[model samples]
Target chain A: MATSTTRLPRAVDPNTVNGWGVDADPRNDPTYPFRDRSREDGPGMAWQRPPLQEPRVEVLRSIEHSRLPAVVGTSTPPKGLSGMIRRAAFRYSESDWRHWLMLLGADRINVVEGIFEDLARGRIPNIPAEMGARAEWRHNKLGLVRKVAIVAAVSAVAVALLRRRGRDDW
Target chain B: MLAAEYRGPYRMRAGRKRMPRIEHPRDALVRVTRSCICGSDLHLYRGMVPDTRVGMVFGHEFCGIVEEVGPEVEKLKPGDHVLVPFNIACGQCHFCKQGLFGNCHEANAEATAVGGIFGYSHTAGGYDGGQAEYARVPYADVGPTVIPDWMDLDDAVMLTDVVPTGYQAAEMGGIQKGDTVVVFGAGPVGIMAARCAWLFGAGRVIVIDHLHYRLDFARRYCPAEVYDFREIEDMAVFVKKQTDSLGADVCIDAVGGDAAGSALHTLFGKAMKLEAGSAIALHWAINSVKKGGIVSIVGVYGPTGNMIPIGNVLNKGITIRANQASVKRLLPRLIEHVQAGRIDPKALITHRMSLEDVSDGYHIFSAKLDGCIKPVLYPNGGQ
Candidate 1:
């Protein structure tokens, strides 16, 4: 690892940045204008906490939080291979890159799982439509064509190699 | 109440939702007049942000009329027209006192990093956004600013996020007199950043993007030099050549996550999902800046890490500054700028649709169709 000395910039004049002192006028201050300073020392967020929403589905909690927040998103709970990967990811600290990388990887895996699930349910998945390829074709025709060609070429080669391997096995 | 709900990736619908009530003493309910589909909102619509639940309303940029207010709210009253800042900050927090309202400790207390954001998903404290007929704004005294009589309602809505974010992008650059500033991505924020760089005394401003219409728009709007990155072979080389081989003094990575350029980044980040989003713009910024330049990032990235060129940052001795723009801190100045006609935030609005057609709005904006730069939604009706 290349360890470098951290160099802090000299104290900058507040005026150096544009619009730095533009809010100096008390009258123009949006949040608090001419408010008594005494209120600053008082307790913040004094409102009573609302009733927590029932977690109808599995809510993934980060390792950093001691408990689930008062409100948590319950949509698309962990399931399938992607869900397992996500569950494993939650085990690690969110600060760790592995945790995030795992989740991102799970997202892609989830897409594939979704397609498989759709096929299993006797519904032909519109991969192009789902991937927003129609819009891509309209807006970025050349780029979309290039991407499709690449995928086609790669798939063709992969299929040919698989067939050769089957003949060798026989 | 009808609100734009997230069904899944690339899916949105204007659906009937429960009317929001002031749950907290400091909360206020606002009848949304005009809301916008921000570039950052596409991240959630595209299923990039974590914990984006189905049926969650997704909007953070809105201007509205206050329908009701809790007893504790002092600054705003019922029937007041206000532009709500995206960040839901408690005024008394340590960060908020320092004017870093985007990192308020009291709001979004569960996770470390980023304050509460309305309609930005669970990752942003799960506060339902203003894409609805009415939205419950927490910390009413701290965030929403009464729209001045002189300001257009469209302009006030943009200030909630885009204008301030773009301004902060340039501000973070610490641009000195006649310094060369290069901004990546010609989206609304990028165009605004390019324009704001001139405000900070930048001699030359350059914008980079793949889209022709957006580049043309940036050229006309920012009146800065624009380049189609698709035409350029190497972004770093092109930037260096433009700046007499010294490189730009400041490079702003206004494009984050969904940036397309490098095949390696696309393969790993988007296809295989090894990283959060493609850090191509960030890479270009780091590589294209001068040895001791500043790379300011106002672009939205996933909470997780991305593949970055930290080694180049160390070797080049670059100063990297990034954050969710503290909208509250910049609001007063921004309001004045809009009033003075220095920055016309409303000019960016190229498409306007009723809230019922939010799905189509999302499609047009996301697809980059009909030369759509910024699409605004009127929940009640157009003014």
Candidate 2:
């Protein structure tokens, strides 16, 4: 692996920040805590918008990144590929997501270790372009697999639809 | 990193809230000079993403001056004016070490679990972004691109996301010398992708979008031929004709989210296609490629749910690469270019307003008013 590259030379830690507290501000007037009261028709209560979220990054830093052990039996919102594969829009299988994780060489343990190490010592890339090249290759490789799967799925659905249409005509 | 968060889903108030701060010792506080609005910010406003807190400051693409540094910081100084990469990475992590800052474990850890961004959500690590009087930037020394005194922060800010993202798209799409590359979207990112594609030495870069204004923008700004996907049919054929009857060697879906990806799904259908959307770009990426060609995805994906067909990838010899746009990868060189006046991303800006007029600017951008492309906010300009 190359030493680290410096796309940004003066990045900082956000964790030590404070006072950006719009949290319960008088700015919201009657609805102090919640902002964006456009939908203020919630009857007596303020209809505030929720915060933008993407906790997958934090989860990836956890011990159980790829394997979700059910978050203490309540099913933990079904994280990782298992949960995502269930969505109809994505059209991917569980194994596919797993394969992608591996293909990208991303693992929970490694991710955690890498983050700490990078923080411990500022990281710089020796072959920065190569890194992008690798992602390009990975995305391309995964895209190929996804296309094939979608084609097969769509083909099956098309054939079934045709059969159902024929039966209906009968 | 303390993100000067733009809390969407919630009406944004014009003020700086520095609630979130750096937890690690390596963090630094940044005095932001310039920040730009991202198209993705619209998603949060529309509530497509869930649970985004209202107090989140909303700047993602920005460049600034380092006001303070951590004890462990080695590469930066307090006075250095720098561009902050959208994703904050420590630069030495396996992914960071590998130059994939988009997937930087520390940067997107929380968001990956929930699929989100700065001021976007707790799922996205809830980092403070640089849309304020002061932004505490994370991974300070690693990702900041020092803007030479001669360089403009407005132009330098492009190094944060759009420009690098655009270049990453071209690289992912496998643009080769003299190859035709089709970018599906003429939004700022799409335009940047075209610009980057041309920069990568591609021949006849083509861009597609529904907006005439944006298409016209691409025709005027990008080095590629432009097409209107809304008015056209048989896109593959049209693109192929541009490539001497050969399909585009590379396809980039700079369009993001389910809507954009779904539009692509309907257009390409089940045929051989390629994509570069948010989470769903990988789905059609393979189908659009020319046999062994490539698809490049640069848009940011939401939390963990992504489904792509894998079997065809095995059959068709196509490859799909994605652009996380490693900031560290481009910082030095991008800074050099900016100082040299070779690239100026600020050309995308068409609207400029004070921090107080952000609501009006947002309205203009939201309505696509008067060919509004990129809107620059000057928080310090007026009372």
Largest DockQ belongs to which candidate?
1
Q: How far off is each candidate at the interface, as Cα RMSD in Å? A: 9.2, 24.3
User: Per-residue lDDT for B1-383 in model 1, tens only?
Assistant: 99987766886777678888766677899999999999999888888887565567889999899999988789999999999999887766545766788876655622556677888865677678988999988778889999999888999999999999998888888776556789999999999998788777666678999899998888777777788888999988887777777788889999888888999988876666566778899999999998888899988888766889999999999989888888998999888788777788889999898898787788778878879899999999954
Question: Docking category for candidate 1?
Answer: incorrect
Fnat for each predicted structure, in order: 0.05, 0.03
Q: What's model 2's TM-score?
A: 0.64
DockQ score for model 1, please? Answer: 0.10
lDDT of each: 0.78, 0.54
Chain A structural similarity (TM-score) per candidate?
Answer: 0.63, 0.19
Candidate 2 lDDT, tens digit per residue, B321-379? 65566666766755655565545688998877655555555545654566878877755
Candidate 1 lDDT (Cα, whole model)?
0.78
TM-scores of all candidate predictions against the true structure:
0.78, 0.64
lDDT of 1 at B197: 81
